[model samples]
Target: MTTAVDVLVVGAGPTGLTLALQAHDHGARVRIVERRPEAFRPSRALIMHPRTLEVLRPLGVTDALLEQADTAPKATLHLGSRAVEASLADLALPDTAFPHLSLVRQTDVERVLAQALADRGVAVERGTELVAVRDDGYGARAVLRTPKGPEVIRCLFVGGCDGPASTTRACAGIGWHGRPYTEEVVLADLDLSGTPGGSGAQLFAGRRGLLFLFPLGEQATWRLLATRASHGGPGPDFGQPGPPVPRSELQHLLGDAGLDARIERLAWSARVPLQFRLARRFRRGRLFLAGDAAHNYSPATGQGMNAGVQDAVNLGWKLGFAASRPHDSTGGRDAEVLLDSYDGERRPAACRRLFLTHTAFWAEASTGPTPSWLRAAAAARAAPLVPVILQRRRLVAEGVRVISQLRVNYRRSPLSVEETPHLHGAPRPGDRLPDATVGVGGPPQRLHALLARPGVHLLLQRDAAPPPHEVLGPHVTALRVANSPGRGLVAVRPDGHVGFRCGKVDAAGLSGWLSLICATGQPPGRPRPPDDAG
Candidate 1:
């Protein structure tokens, strides 16, 4: 059997699901396939950072995630027996909605995304495996094995959202580089007897090693992470792959960490070898890699899933624009430029996150005697200053900003255009527009709510007159904003980032910029009649 679509997603994980949703929303015909027979059952990546929440807001899944997730606005670190608290309240970024870490099971996250895709009339084809992919200059073809028989799929673009061992990446000949961490880490979800005071997540550092406990919403259910250093094992080498650690061993480790909790029942457990790796390239012809398929990082920073979702969001709209060329007057040349921008923009972001997670893993998982002693000493010294430092609103805000990834920008990307010179302090092209309250009286609304619609958005100051519909084109949705920081008009991409910002509305310049990035050679939709000014 053979089928055709605008975009063929090779994996149905969070990354692929997100890509499908975004692409579908932008009018691209998308089909997603997953090798897994069913949805993931285990709770893998648990932390959803603020920036990820923002990126997903446009997809209409943020509300569902918020309902099912537990928000941790603060984090507690235990040094020996004493505990230090770090406030995450300051992370409530200036122009955004989400301000804290959302702790939810990875299964639930996937469930919500899958439902959203279903609502859009796209169902993930489970039990379908992509055996091969071939990308010619114009389009790509994928061969899949299904229960019935062999199936072939042809599409203009293919997204490799598969796991670290990605078939799409392998077929594309992209090289994965980097080494694995020497230590073996264990993760488990268990029910506990004793309870902690706050609902926030906790990290314990002791002579034995490091233990991180995250409350699972229930009375005493928690997710625990521990390193071999805390397991009383001999060195890093365990000789062979062993079964899950016994419940008795977990209880002992908890007791050593000064926790009064006792393990009631273990729901799940796994021993994993952490690795830090990135693909040599993210794009090859009509195929591109995202998520674990593109880069793999330590679980310490809890960024693996968030980064992958962002990758899909970044690539979805670009692929949509390229696929929509037939409706517009633009040729394949513009589509090529749009597709190439994906690799140029996303690779650097992944590199930055990889560096952060690597640094954090070593800092927390250092095992040698000297490193242990130094960590203890540093923790003791810093414990006293934590409260004082956290009390300063500015300091706390800055710390949260860095960790939340809200500062990530694509100012250097080819898609970003800054035509107006000397514009100071305002958001530049390629920067995410801060979520702010817009509209007046009737009710308060978020900027993202307006951007949730399909196509580019032209945000005009409340008092400013909107450009003629003919001048702006049907593809552009114009909205009037109240309390907007700056005058003039800002062109926001489908992904919710500022694409072009000008002091005043330049219909010609704005249209030209759109052509450059979106490949809409002529104004989209119905052509506007010539005005007296023109």
Candidate 2:
């Protein structure tokens, strides 16, 4: 069998599903193909940061997802013997109504996304693996292995969210660059009681290794992660099982450090390596990669999933915008440029995460046996700066009321322009819009509510009126504000970030800027303006 689609997504994980769902909502015919015969076993990624909640709310499922989660307002970080916590009670979450982390399993998230896609009339094919992928000038050709038989799929664009061993990436001949940790990590989901929330995170620093216990769902389950002994040089293959580590071992290792708890080992224990790798390229022709396919990092920061989801969110709109455009207007290059930017922007961010994770691993007490003297030294060293580091990490992790997602700035793109400061003006491409609750006044009943609707948003400052707002697809909204210094006519991307801004609320300037960055310099029906107009 053979099929044609506007976009063919090559993974069924959170990232791919997000892309699929968003593209479908934006009016594109899309299909998702996953190698696994079923929803992949839900393994990690339980923390849904505040920024994600903002994105999910716009999709109309934030409440439903929160129903399945335990909302925690703080994340604690333990440095040796001292534990300091960052409370979400005080974060400036941008563009979100709910600013907190939801502890929902990755499986639950995938299930939610899959259902959303289904409700929107998009189907995901399970057990359909892409064996070969080739891209020519016209489109992408993928040889797929379906349950019934072999098939070929032709798509205007392909998104690879296929995990670390991504065949799609390898087929594209992209090299993954990074280093792997010599230590192995043991992950266990165990039943627990009385773990404190907002008590922050617990870090055990011992000579043998480091053990961490994170609050999972009202203390019923705690995520226990530990680093393997480096001196032992990789213990018996993690595949084999051994008696639960003696309570004395836990005490000797981390128990004495601070955590007063017992391990009730359950039915599951698996060892995974701490490795960091990123694809040398984010895209190859019509084929593009996101999530673990594009990058992989240690679970230290719990960013693997969040980063992947962001990748999906970033690429989804671009693909949707490009795919839905008329061919005559795009000249066929629109899709390529929009798709190529996904890798260009996301790859560097992933690399930074990899480096940060490594730094965290090196700081672990498990790097070697904790000597009594070393523990004292660690506690002493942590007394000063550990608290600061812990706060930043916790804030980043929980992201409740924080700008984790919207904090990303894309101003460095070749598409951006430099602007000067003005009294009442538009925001620049990379600036984050301050949070404001606009009451029902303009066309839309509410302010952020207007964002829930489709199209780019241009918020103008007081005393500035945008030139007769032109209609372009579901694109561009112009609004006026009372006091927006250097933030007039702030153009926000569909995913909700300031994409283009003007100094004087110049309609032609705003339009020209939007045309350059948002639409790749082409306004649907408008003629190109003179160079100085910008």
Candidate 3:
């Protein structure tokens, strides 16, 4: 039988699941399919950065993930006898509600996201594989092979969140252009004898290679990641076939790092050949690519899954806006423009992250004697200054800001419309609106919490009156704030970035921007102004 949906998601991993959930939340009919019959059982992508937590706040899963995850406020690095720790706490990010790194299994994250989708009446169609896709200008049709038989799905758009080997990307003729690293990395989950060094994640660097130990919340349970050289001599080539990493190998690496923890059990292990690749284009016709399908980077910084999730967050609302438009009206053109903006904004961000991860990997993975000696010497020289650096609040804050990805901006995006100079230190168009306490005495509420509602959020300063509802359209929500640093209005996009900012509320400007991005066939509905208490 031939079925139809507004959006057909090609994969059901974290990226695809997030896209499906957000698309459904935005009132789009989304159907997600996974080739795998069941969800992954093993845990991967353990760290959820602060920015990811903030972006996920509106999805209602952040709290659930926090409940199941562990927070690492400090990361300690041990080089010989010298130990330096970098604080991951939010001493720098006072505006954000979540200012620390969250350590949660990827399986748990998928479970939470999948349950949220189930609550919304959408279940992932397992064992449904996309065989082919064809775009005929207006919409796309996908050929899927289900357990029963082959079924055709006609949809307005196709989201390719199918990981590195993306069928959607190949069908769209997008090129995955990059190279893989020469060295291999082995990751394993281990049951340790006791606390390994400290509560937070620990890095042990030496002339051999680098080893990382991350606590998995439970007592004595930890995740270990080490370079091939760190496992004693050049380990098996990950590019070629390899055997399972033995438990003794893990123990030896731990011992080499000065850790005395005994491996009670080797729960799981895998050898991964790192790669840094990005798609040439994110969109082709009615097809869109996101997550690992769009870009793949080294996992050294633990950014692969987080970047993929953020990719979904960035593309989800855009897809929702496009799908909300009527097919017969001029909405098609506006939707195309909105969809095209995805590449402009997300590609650069992915490239930046890829560069950061690659640099970080080589910085710690280089096995050359000269580079290793230099790193060790630097660590030795800086050990005494670690206390002073941690004490200086400004330095620690700056470091946190960079690594947390709070500094990412899309000012170069064509969709970012900025006008008028700001008197207050409010964020500019394309910058993420810093989360802050938004309510009066009755317990502080976060800015993101106010944006739980779908669509573009128009945040009006305390003195500013709400604009006529008809001008903003149904997809736009206006919230009058009691305390705003800026005496103007800021239009926060679905992804939490500022879309439009002005010193005063410009209904005409807002309407123009909305008309371009959120064009629809229906007439403007009645204004649903938020309560004054907001």
Q: Give per-residue CA lDDT, model 1, range 164-271, as digits (tens).
A: 888999999999998877765777888887665444788877655678887762323787887654334333222122357788878887877678877878886756
Give the per-residue lDDT digits (tens) of candidate 2, residues 276-321.
Answer: 7788888888788888888876665567777788788778777777
lDDT of 3 by residue, 1-534 (tens): 476788999999899999998788776899999998988645657788888888877788888888888764567878678777776655756878776767788888998999999999999999999999989886898999999999987998999998888899999999989987765677777787777565478888766568888776223367787875433344443222235687877788788777777887777776666667889999998899998889887777788788888889888888887877776656767777788888888898888888888888787776776657755666667778778877888777666667667888889876688666452567888998888878733666877777866677888887775776667667777787776644588888888888888787776776767766676225446556755663
Cα RMSD for candidates in order: 4.1, 5.8, 3.2
TM-score of 2: 0.81
lDDT of 3: 0.78
**Residue 312 in model 1: lDDT:** 95
Model 3's TM-score against the true structure:
0.91
Question: lDDT score, residue 350, model 3?
Answer: 84
TM-score of each: 0.90, 0.81, 0.91
By TM-score, the candidates rank as: 3, 1, 2
Query: Model 1 segments beyond 4 Å from truth?
Result: 72-74, 86-92, 196-199, 217-220, 229-243, 327-330, 421-425, 439-445, 462-465, 468-474, 482-487, 521-534
Taken over the whole model, the C-alpha lDDT of each candidate is 0.76, 0.63, 0.78
Show where candidate 2 strays beyond 4 Å.
74-88, 92-99, 192-203, 215-220, 230-262, 328-330, 333-335, 365-376, 380-406, 418-426, 439-449, 469-471, 482-488, 505-507, 513-534
How many Å off is the CA of 227 in candidate 2? 1.9
